[model samples]
Target: MSSLSKLAYYLLHNHSRIAANLVEQGIKEMNIKIPDEEKDHAVCVYETFFQFMGDSLEQETNEIPSKLIEWSKKNAEGQIFSGGKISEIIIRYPVTRKIFADLSTQWAEEFSLTNKESIKILQKMNAMLDVSEVETVFAFEKLTKQMKKDYQKELDTLSNPIVPLKEGIAVLPLVGTIDSYRVNHLMEKVIPEIAHLNLNYVIVDFSGVQTFDETTASYLQQIGSVLRLLGIRTILTGISPQLAQIAVAIGAEFHDVTSYTNVKQALENI
Candidate 1:
């Protein structure tokens, strides 16, 4: 290992407690509160810093591995479990990175390092922070996808409602595009909700739906058949000409399902 890496390894390993204390100070400088739910999480954050710097200094090339990126991701996942907000990673930690960088320069200067040594120390410090920042973003993006999926599922349940109008009668209004995801939700979530409603008659209104693919149209046709097997009578409403054409083109068997022009007309006529 280089002289610089050796010096770093000595400081990080022998003086780990001091380094961890400095990390906590840097975090406090950001004014980011460590909530009670995530109390132990604060310790993990500092411990992660110690491990990363110590391990990087131990390595010969001064280069961190890709799997070592998991170090950052694991810390982030801990934050979630510990009640640390995602904003802490995105907003607060950038400030902490700057603080840690400043501390590294001060330490190098205090050690009376030459200009060459000082530059090498800063370079190593920058390299470590760069990896952490990049990996943290990847972990945050994963959290965002999971969070969005859950929110969308809630919104879907709200938007595609199964409203009970009267005894043994319910209306399900489908709006917007019908994709495979929506089809699966209909069969899974909506079907169960329909069953729980204990309605003998269900009015599946499609007037608000703008478009649907062949697969979606075929799935829609199956809704009536599935309900009929459960002894519920399903009357389809708001069949736009485009939807009708798509249904016919897909060779979907809709002969057994009854159709009405609109929800209002279906309610009045049925």
Candidate 2:
């Protein structure tokens, strides 16, 4: 192995011990009031960066840094699941990089390396640190997107509910305003539920829904069509005058679907 590679390997092999000590030093240097769990996370973060740096030097390849950046994005996601914030690493990286860079300089001095060789190692260390900053931010954004989707799914489940009125009869009372997301989720959820329940008729009560746009009127038409194909009849109730006007404005015709004034009226008819 090359001399630089050997040095890097030696540093990596002692990384855990060095990181444990560095955590205390870093806390003092940063002067941040962090919890015990955060201290442990700091140790882990330091170890990961040390391992990445060691591999960069050991492999002597231009691609390892890029690969490490990709891997850190996934790593950041996992860390979020474990209650570690991306901001923690972002806030602490400057100090951590300085400590590691100083350690590398000390190593260079030990090897009797000249000024030019020392500068090259410092340059590589700074570049890796830069890559880390970008990757951590990207990972945080990925986590945010995942969280948003999960929240939307939960909202979909909450807003769309199928309550069985009797054998082969059900009521779907939609709450709040209609958006494209809720409309899509309703079709996705209600279609399978109707088939599974063997429902012949469903009373769609929109009394709680405050408003809907032209797109929502289109979705209602589509839902009626899908229910007809599945051999389940949909009876829509609670068409306020404003909603009726919107339906007319949008030129939506629901000739195939039945309409009622309210759920009670629809139930009485059945």
RMSD of every candidate to native, in Å, equals 6.0, 4.3
Q: After superposing candidate 2, which stretches have Cα over 4 Å from the reference?
A: 1-18, 35-41, 44-75, 82-85, 98-115
Check candidate 1 and list the clashing pairs: none
How well does each candidate superpose onto the true structure, as a TM-score? 0.62, 0.71
Best by lDDT: 2
**What would the per-residue lDDT of candidate 1 be over residues 53-155, giving only the tens digit for each residue?**
5676566457665544775787677766666766667675567667666766776766655677666656766676687777877887787689789988997
